[model samples]
Target chain A: MKRITHFYSLTPEWQHSFAKEMGGELIDNKIIVIPEDIGHGYSYFTQVTPGISVLYVDFVLDTPIKITRQKSDNELYIFHFDMSEHVNLIRINKIDYRIGTHEDLGLAIIDNKMKSTFKPAVGDRTLAVRLLVDKKLLDEFIKTHPSEEHGNRKISVPKKSLYYYDHIDSHSMLLIRSIKDRSVFDSSFESYLKGISLRLLGNFLDRYEHSQAVKDEITDVEIESVTKTQTYLLDNLYNPFPSVPFLSKMAGMSPSKYKMIFKKQFHNTPKNLFIEEKMILANRLLQSGDYKTLTEVIYELNYSKLSYFCSKYYELFHRKPADDLVKKKYNQKCITKSTLQ
Target chain B: MKIIEHSFGPDLDWLPHYAEQLGGKIDGNFIIAPDNGIRYILPCGEGISAFYVDVTYNSDFHKIQKNRDTDFIGLYYNLTDGEATLTARDFMYNVSRWHYNLSVIDGLINTDYVVKSGSRTYGLAIFIKKSIIESYAKKENIVINQIEEITNPEKNTIIRFDRMSYDSYYILEELHKQKVGGPIFDFNLAGTVHLLISNYLRKLSTNKIILQTVNQTDLNNIILIQKYLIEHAEETFPSIKQMADMANMSESKFKILFRKITGSTPNVFFMENKLIKAKELLEEKQYSISQISDKFHFTNNSYFTSKFKEYYGLSPKIFIKHL
Candidate 1:
């Protein structure tokens, strides 16, 4: 670990999300976008090289890095990823920084920088890992995303597992180190995406899940119940939502503590989360072509203000629910009743 | 063949009251009537095969479990919560398909499908078979084409497509529509699957895949292994060295003809496979810029997210939720 001053450009996600509003570029090409959120955190990143020329950012946040998302609406996003492969080397920066989950979320590095990647020296370039995830869906993800436990181990990571090259050394980690931490392209404007390869992740989860801290505190049953609660919230998004007090009673968590844990784990207010859920349901519902106006969705969700609901929907989704109806041109029956084919 | 009785409840004696289908699970004790014969019993949520393995149950599962994608992901979502008024049977019925339906997955290619771009995956997995064009090529006599079968193919390649592609829809509207009879492997909606399989085999013969010693089972494992490598390079480094270490074999022998079996060099395979997770996260718009970066172990947020934008011509976030 070398001590030096360091700066890391915001991952391309910020630009990707705000590209139309704010365009930018990358440095060193060391970063890779994970293409997923850290659930309650911002996103994922990694380091590629052990090069001395690069400046590295400290993982501990004695300092605050200001991050800005599109100023449309408040959205809560969830991302679950694993970085146990890379050796986690926490270093002392002597810099007073408290990294908050509300900001860039969790970032794990693989480099053997146990000493210092950035300190004292004003300019230091550090190796970085990269990842990629969709933004707009994340915005909408703020809505209705459930606070679920990490159960099913599809992709298994070993417990407290860290890789330091005992194998043929494909330098496979090198490629992960290679991709820049920026959004590749916002070219495809897709309203939906299906990940066929998700099944592979099951194994990674299967292996590492046994040792991770998530398993230690919450029970699988508790996680399941949380998921159920989220589902119920989505189903009734359009109706007057149950109060947090009532919801806490239902989930068996006290209202105050539930709010704290839920937000810490999921990074969304229950109400905001509920609104997001209703918005998604609204999308599916509006797709059915039955609801002709955004006003109807607002009415369905039992919002106090129609404009507030519409604006909130736009912020969460970065699009209008009514707009989908206009584009599809098929009324509710046609949209919902279409053959599954 | 007789399908055995599979039901689950909290107690071993709780039987004769419920029936379960393929993958139908309960938050209680598990029961199975094995097709291989005899009754197999285990606790709920166990991955035990009909023989040998015992189900793993713990009071702590509620804490460790995250999200799940199963027929009953919604049912076991919350167990023993006093509000779980509905019976497990009803929930099963809701997500359960009396008979599984097969459809070709279709949507805007990038929107509905994903190709992994990380190290942890096997090989390229087409969400819906891209053999639509090849299927047409086969029917029209393309001399360059041939089909090969996988005996114990890679599980990644063996995955199911949940929707029909637009091309298949075009073929379906024009051709005679009929149900695919017999085994799941026999079904071909637009000949896309068969063509895809054949193309895979042909590629195996000529391209990166080498037959090695011509052993059939190894060939299948190689194919599956190739798929696994192709789909998860970013997240995995199960190289010849890793496997050799696991199996206590020499790396030299492992490297000599490794490519002969899978076709591509391990390094290339690793790179290609990593994309699967990267691409999947890139399309699921719910993730933030940095979230995607860390999932695949991109060292730098700026670099990872930038590469993502460069690869797809849009940031991971914008590309999926396209602004």
Candidate 2:
């Protein structure tokens, strides 16, 4: 395993050091495409605004590597979105945290005072983005959007570090996907990246503030159980919905209590979330073009009745399975026509 | 005409005060007009602000002018069903339906526009500071000297109008679908604005169409005719002789310049708009295929179906199913 040292500040020294350690050449002082021997993507870093900076990572490592950064005096809030196929393991101030790969929880926010080491899983692709924000600006932003119980719920950043592990909500995920789809070859790529970076930062701050206001209602132990149960449900999407009593037993609580806590955390009842995930999976299977027929898709997703499946799919996506099939066939025809042309 | 003047800048404090005069009240980041429409102001960051308005007035012919001193770029998108004319510097533009609806205007030049009452007008204005645009351009190694020259306050302002691409249209549709005051509404609004601005910039960088300096009077006349065509899309396209007389030009000259300015023949443009309107009606789910076909004056249902499929790559029924 190769150990790489890097820093988060937007300075030439930091860029040069990281590029040198990775044996990659820097381009235009902002991007460094990792050497082919180690990875196949680039790391882009830039200051989006005066008090906000972003570091975008999209690469797949062939060899094991660990990125270690020293503690910094520059007080900044780092919002990290580990959007990878596999989980990212990080150690911050001697506490190990596994981030990403769970739909319900993936993003992590940490203070710059804590030293960290990021170990990305090899072979699987790694996609992560980090926003470094000035503490003073964030503090001012918090003061403006004061919650109802702002007096006691205030997260005054004195000297102690703040760490928040949260879920990358569906909206943020869509924004992330949009950012990923942007082409670097475009002449106006930098401007587009900066604009989206500002949006992602704004979104993170809003979520952070809302989470702070609601922090007093839930206990840590309860949160742990809810997270465990949610992950379980997400992992078992192809299976039929587990009964309420069964899920509550897994979370070690009464069925009603489990349902309430699950709703509070995930913003949906457990059964609804399961069905939604299943429908999403079903849609993907239909669109993937691997299945031969609609019956195959239904069977793959463990659906008992075609009519029931179609109604649930419509309820979720506002389109029926037959519609998707028509679109797929139409798209295939267009592809063939273009190829012939 | 009721004349209203507004100062354009990053600060949106004047909006709520101005909305009050029009029988509206501020609700958080939104200005609510009980009978008119609602407007949202989202300040993304230091130098970026998004303003969205969907309003119609009881009174007729209100002329609004935006007053500004500093230079900036205003990315304006109009998705309206109304008659409006905008005059930015010397060039006049008709806010026509469907086609060429995105306007990239220079903020240094004052913009004046008049909107007819009783018709809904939906618009989004994203105000971006020139300094910020300069920084992005400089860092990206894109020489925007041409942009600077075109947007010079002292020179005659030349606004760039583009047909909003299908992708951008879908993005705006998604943004419009978002409910206000959700836990993540502000973030979503900012995100959508970011995508819109980025998409516009991408188009700006890759633009290849030469902006010919058409004669001002001829351009205005063409715009007027285009507006007429859009307003009467359901009706048959007028003959070339009548259209040429309307534009005060000979038929040969009319055919050449119409294609040059709008990138389509007059009849093609008319039919394109009719099909677009037909698609919208189909999405509304209020009319069937035969009704829409008859409404658009198509010969029959099969003809309408073929034309729709040829234009949009799917029959009306399938499009409805997909929707």
Candidate 3:
């Protein structure tokens, strides 16, 4: 993977590497564009404001391609607004986060060398708007528009890097609409794009600042321990999870405090989350067809009886485990018969 | 320190040019300070002129006087690290950091004084024309008796000074971080100016301490009544007769005093308080519209919805949707 810091520097490199695949022109000394190609529809760089830039992408590809880039040390924050029907999975620092259409906005804060991968499906159209903003500029903007808890403190750039998903609001939807609007005149197109882009940015910052304010109230140690507890739960999903007292002790907190803070962060009680994770794991295992029989699946998941496993699975998936196994087997048989024919 | 004077009003488009003449640099819609510090003069609509001063230099006395050719109220906000005296005619008053002052200025007798030195002085000043405020008061159907009194030709140039509250300080700090240009800059500047001015006027209207003639016991009772209304926001508001009995005054006298001290009728004050609380609840997004209306004791959801729209220019449902 190639590592680059500045956005402008990444552009020429992309143009060179994908010379035959994509070609683009520069605009206003700030924006670079790759006009519609044979497979790709359109992609353009728009400098929304002084410190904010947006890359509008619409692509229809013929084969699966994985494009990876290492973002060097810089102060840019990236936001991916997925507008397509399919989910786009992006990996940042080896963790995968799914950005779905109109459901959630993906946020990536790049402070150091971090790897990012973008994979689009073959023969499917994908549309997305990528916004890159200078962190200093955003921090300054947020300071003037202080949210509940983010008033006095400076935004912390975590060492490990961070990626999260935020819910889409109406303002974000408006921004997407404006970006997709193509009737703007060529003469005023740049300014028009800049105006709408900033408005979209303003909307994003408003929500971002409010959430940051809430996050500021949680102490660093508490955040670390909660994260630890989450990992522990995920690792022990098949086994009987530890009690609240035991988990709290591991996290250096009283049981009640741990439960309250855990619920506040994850929006679920420890036991409920344990059950949820177990059900998810069981579903994945069943769909993968690694376990042939119902008893095999139940034993693998550490359930004492088949009935207990089926009951829990039914509660989570609204279907019996045996039904899912039967469905998977029938689907495999149909695929084999069709391929053979 | 450079001293430059220019008369500005609602239609003055050349204000930015004049600002540039005073060692300030004009970049698009923003006026940047040269070497010394930063400054921006934004002419917000409704005849309200807002400007920021962040100058640091060495001088014994640098006076930036606005030769007011029309009736206007000058709101001064001192942010940090500066001491200056405001001298108008025979009266001289000292004002320093974290101080907020409101003054009514007329062209002939009331010359605005801003005494400064060679140290860094950060502050904001908003000049709102008398006509504009009067129109706003009429549109909002709110009483601004203090403004009327201060703008009277017979009255002296009334200068009322108060300490900056924490909310106001936080807002000022936020204003300092605005460095963009173009329509977005203007939009943020106008919104902030309106908010700051509204906050100051709200405080001035409600505060009884600025009224020197009011006795200590009456002032205390008025403050207590204000606090009582805020604490009992969900309860049935007290009638004028009931509140008068509590304050040991006649009903007519209670109504007059309450209006004078709070710059709003008791009923209007209570409604405004409820609306403020409603806005916070709407922002929280935890309750539905019906739940919030019931919690605030509104007669019905429609009535609450109408009142919320009238006050915030947006309905509760729409507001929550935007959130």
Candidate of highest lDDT? 2
Candidate 3 chain A — worst ten consecutive residues by lDDT sum?
Answer: A1-10
Give me the runs in candidate 3 sitting further than 4 Å from their true place.
A1-341, B1-3, B13-17, B58-61, B68-71, B100-118, B137-159, B163-166, B177-185, B211-323
Q: A103-129 in candidate 2: lDDT tens per residue?
A: 345787777778889998898878888
> Tens-digit lDDT track for model 2 on B232-278?
98987789899899999999988887877666789988888898788
Q: Pick the candidate with the highest DockQ.
A: 2
Chain A of candidate 2 gets a TM-score of 0.59
Candidate number with greatest TM-score: 2
- Tens digits of lDDT, candidate 1, A224-263: 5566667778777657778888877777767886676567
Q: What TM-score does candidate 1 reach? A: 0.25
**Model 1, stretches more than 4 Å misplaced?**
A1-341, B2-205, B208-212, B215-240, B247-249, B306-318
Model 2 chain B: lowest-lDDT 10 consecutive positions: B204-213
lDDT of 3 at A220: 57
DockQ of 1: 0.02
lDDT of 2 at A316: 92
Candidate 2 whole-model C-alpha lDDT, 0 to 1: 0.73
Cα shift from native, residue A151, model 3 (Å): 31
